[model samples]
Target: MKLIHAELIKLASLLSAWIAAGLATILPAAVAVLNSRSQVSRGIDAGFQDLAPGVIGAIVIGVVAVSSEYLVEGAESGGGRQITTSLTAVASRSRFLLAKAAAVAVTVALLALLSSAITLTTTSLTDETVSVGTADLPRVAGVTAYWILTALLASGITLVTRSGIVPLTFCIVNMSVVSVSFLLTKLTSWANYLPDLAGMHLFLRDVHGSVDIAPLTGGLVMGLWVVVVAGIGFIVFRRRDA
Candidate 1:
């Protein structure tokens, strides 16, 4: 419990978390407002679809949690890394990782919830034709779950790499520039089961792909990926020297 609290405090202190919060809230809300006010007619699902871009924020949350620990201090600070101190204090790698992961998950879930509320409300006010009601609660919950899973995926990758560069770039690019997995869907229907693609079904009514994934099935598939990545990261984190 102490470890979890400490980890949460560490996350709260990070500027990256604040930047991530901005991405999660601002991007979606801005998109919703634009969709609402624009002359171009969009489906009533515009608000929900806007949530897609916010995954970048979730990815950032995961990467920075691990990456921040690995950052080496300058020579003036004895050129040491925080991970060494963290491990020295905790003594148990599993406990430390678990606590850190929990912290990241909690931070991301809250961000997701906030983003959903702001974005949905923006849409509802901007376009009276779009209504958000109790029925959308489940989808909102799904969005939070999706963000948690996405954050975990980023955390797992960062743990193994011990650096944020690769994981952060890949995840941000995948969500922003172009989806490598989404492109693969053209060649194989099974690509529809990829984490991001499947996860989108949780809140999105219209996914531009050939395969049709039920929300529950998509969540299951994404969850499976999270388990696999987390397991691999745990093994690597345990065996590798800090």
Candidate 2:
């Protein structure tokens, strides 16, 4: 409990978290407003609808939470003073990482939920799209889980490279490439099993024209990936000199 509080404080104290959280809120809100204002003269565009503002804003949250560590040694939120404070508060490396991960998950989940609400409400005001409902809960949960795991995986990669810029750039490129591949129908079968794909599969149910992977399968793949990456991160963090 103390460790978690300490980790939460460390995260809350950082400028990066403030900036990322603000952007996470504002960018999506802005997009939702724009989407609401844009004319929908044609038919319902499922593709545009699937590209929800929350989903896009999550990309930034994912990158910053994971890669920010590299920018400030021992501080996932990125600041020298806060890093020192965190270390002084929590001596166990495993505990520290675990606490940080939990903090990030909680904070991001709240952010995602808020952004989703904003996007849906704004789009609703436009009358072009109906707000997502209980039927969409499973898919929304999946996207949130995927975002947390993706951030953890990014952290693992940062542990390996120790360069924030590298991981941040990689995330942008990887997401873009994945988005492009999603446009190819022939690949949806296997692509549906990919880490991010599983989440997207749930987000835009019509992407593959059907759910290729069951929701359970998607959750399992995402969970397993997080476990594996976190294991690797733990090993490296324990052995490496900080």
Candidate 3:
């Protein structure tokens, strides 16, 4: 409990978390508002599509949470990295990593929920024709789950690299409006199985040029990716020097 609380406090103290949260809340609504004015048909899954921009915020949350620990406070003063301090205090790498993961998961989940709610409400208000049916409730839930999973994925990758730049750049670029994965899907069918693309199938009603998997199956595939990557990260963190 102490470890988890400490991890939470450490995360809360970072400016990146607040910035990510703010972006997560505002970006989606702004996109929805702009989308409402356009007559172009964004297909049946427009709500989820409109909320896509907010995923960047979740990615940032995950990357920064793990990467911040590796940053040097003052190299000249020999302050060392926060990871050293964290490990010294906890004295158990596994426990500390788990605590950090738990803190990030909880924080990202709350951010996802709030951002999803805001985006959904704004989209509905702006475009009355956009109606969500009873069957779509599961997809709405899937959106939140997808955001959480993406955040975890980022966190795990950051742990392995011990640097935010690489993971952040790759994730953000791969998930952008004209994503490389999406483009590659046109040339190769296997590209659809990429983590981001497969995960998006969980909530997307009409995905273009991708494998057609059930929502539950899509979520499972994405979850499996997170598990594998995060497991590897945990192992490396345990064996490597702080």
Q: Rank the candidates by TM-score, best first.
A: 1, 3, 2
TM-score of 3: 0.94
Clashing pairs in 1: none
Candidate 3: Cα lDDT at 231: 96
Predicted candidate 2 versus true structure: per-residue lDDT over 86-169, tens digit per residue: 556678887888877787777778877666666556656665455456766665565566666666666666666656676667
Residue 162's C-alpha lDDT in candidate 1? Answer: 91
Candidate 1's C-alpha runs over 4 A off are: none
* Model 3 ranges off by over 4 Å: 75-78, 133-135
lDDT of 2 at 53: 36
Which of the two, 1 or 3, has more lDDT? Answer: 1
- Per-candidate local distance difference test: 0.91, 0.60, 0.86
Deviation of model 2 at 85, angstroms: 5.9
Off by over 4 Å in 2: 36-88, 128-131, 176-189, 209-211
Comparing candidate 1 with candidate 2, which one achieves the higher lDDT? Answer: 1
Residue 74 Cα positional deviation in candidate 3, in Å, after optimal superposition: 2.6
Prediction 1 TM-score vs. true = 0.97
The number of the candidate with the highest TM-score is 1
